[model samples]
Target: MSKHPKPNALIWLILSVVVIALDQWSKAWVLRDLPEYTAIPVIEGFWNWYRTYNTGAAFSFLSDAGGWQIWFFTGLAVGISGLLTFWLSRAARGDWRQALPYSLVVGGALGNVIDRLMHGHVIDFIQWHWRDHYWPAFNLADSAIVAGAVGIALFGLFDGKRSKKA
Candidate 1:
């Protein structure tokens, strides 16, 4: 390991904090402002502010599993976050491309885990639709996780090519 890590690692950490804060804050605001399963239009047909509580994983999978999934998911999130934190601590500080995605994942995981622990379910508020079809409602933490996944994928693809050329 280098004696000094990359400066951008700090930036990644800051970004992770911001993501977690914003995710939790937005969820808090929604809980205070909206009723359960209520939709408030944000962009007419394209988007809306809708509140929902998901007790299961994506798309409400295992949501009706008689409540055992709450602890299971919570445990998974805690484990994943711990592993990510360890990776982040060992990562080169300047390697923002590598660190940022993991940071985002860690932050997002914690954000949702907080909700699960506090409310028995994760709050989701953003909704999108097209014609008669609708996408499942999700929150900022979910967005961050998806974005982080994309970032990591892109970095793996492009960064490897660039490094080999250099």
Candidate 2:
């Protein structure tokens, strides 16, 4: 039998909860304070608080799927979150390289899932645009997920070499 030291799963769980709370709270605040398709400039030419709902996947793919996409995305989020939680449990302490990313992903997935379950779609608000082109609206959770994914990828690339030498 192999004795593996479990990571500080509690920390990950707490962080995940905090992420979910912040994500939900911000969405709720936006829903209450902002109107659909309305933009409130936050940084002039850089960003704005714009309310929009996504019924599809990233970049609004399949957004016009006639509503079936709502359930599909919801289910996908839930599934991903579940898998992340399981992964977190198996992670070893001091393995922030892996656990941190999993935690972030879990948080983001749950955040969007809550929106889908409650609003029948995901509420997005943050907007970025250049002089002419506008980027897709997103929320904090999406940012966290992207950051975590990048961390994981970078760490994997660098850590692989170190592990090979050990």
Top candidate (lDDT): 1
**lDDT (CA) for every model shown?**
0.86, 0.85
lDDT measured at residue 110 in model 2 versus the true structure, 0 to 100: 84
The runs of at least 3 residues in candidate 2 whose Cα sits more than 4 Å from the true structure, single-residue gaps closed, are 1-10
TM-scores, all models, native as reference: 0.89, 0.91
Q: What overall lDDT, based on C-alpha atoms, would model 1 receive against the true structure? A: 0.86
The window of 10 residues in a row where model 2 has the poorest summed lDDT is: 4-13
Estimate, for each residue in 39-113, the C-alpha lDDT of model 2 and write its tens digit.
899999889999999988789999999998888888887888887787777777568888888788888888988
- What is candidate 1's lDDT per residue for 1-166, written digit by digit as tens? 6685444354466777888899999998998889887779889888989999899988998989988999999999889878777777777787778798988888888889989999999999999998779999999999888888888899989999999999
| Winning candidate number (TM-score) | 2
Instruction: Please list all clashing residue pairs in model 1, or write none if there are none.
Output: 6-93, 6-94
Query: Worst ten-residue run, lDDT, model 1?
Result: 4-13
